[model samples]
Target: MSELKKIPADIAELSFEAALKELEQIVERLDSGQVDLDQSIEIYTRGSLLKQHCEDKLRSAQEKIDKIVNQNGTLGTEPANVE
Candidate 1:
């Protein structure tokens, strides 16, 4: 691997879709076995970060949905008056 180049964008800054796309690309590259061990290690680290970011994004979305459901009384909390 030549000098283990840094990924240009911060993983946290990427939206969930972009991060997942990059992570998928990394998986493809690693699966192809074309990358050198050092490069693989570097990208693997980034992939893990992307995975965690994706998970965090999903968790946040779920929490928001749960709150909405609770407010609507779908999850057993008091329902907001609808009229």
Candidate 2:
């Protein structure tokens, strides 16, 4: 059996350029509709995984944001700072 190249682990830390290129290929494959049902399903699954990976990365980065920090031990309003 051959190794499947679309594993989330492979793309979880991929650079934006690499991930976007792979995502584009998946979209092209899906758009062409030339693949069999199984292949289509696999492609769709991979696309979803890639989408989730991107979203996870975004969320992880967003988590570091300090939202309305009670800085100086005072309950004051402050803009969230994304570090």
Candidate 3:
């Protein structure tokens, strides 16, 4: 019997680059059409999770960048007026 495949639950901990790399690999594999239907579904699910993780990491980084500011002639931080 084939073992059940599993997706990692710690995707949230992966860095932006790592998650993006995994997402790219999933895309390449799906594009190749080498996987069976079940495998395709599983991998597609994983890819979705990876995509969300990458997006969250990017948003967090953007927030940090927006927070950067200059105060009192010295480097400081303030909430950015992001629209």
Against the true structure, what is each candidate's TM-score? 0.74, 0.59, 0.73
Q: How far is candidate 3 from the true structure (C-alpha RMSD, Å)?
A: 7.5
- Worst window of 10 by summed lDDT in candidate 1: 74-83
Off by more than 4 A, model 3: 1-8, 71-83
Q: Pick the candidate with the highest TM-score.
A: 1
Clashing pairs in 1: none
Q: What is the lDDT of candidate 3?
A: 0.79
Model 1 regions more than 4 Å off: 1-9, 70-83
lDDT of 2 by residue, 1-83 (tens): 64344555677778655776777899999899899999999888878777666655555555544344576987555554443
Once fitted onto the true fold, the runs of candidate 2 whose alpha carbons sit more than 4 angstroms away are 1-7, 65-83
| Candidate 2 positional error at 50, Å | 0.5
Poorest stretch of ten by lDDT in candidate 2: 60-69
Error of 2 at 17 (Å): 3.6
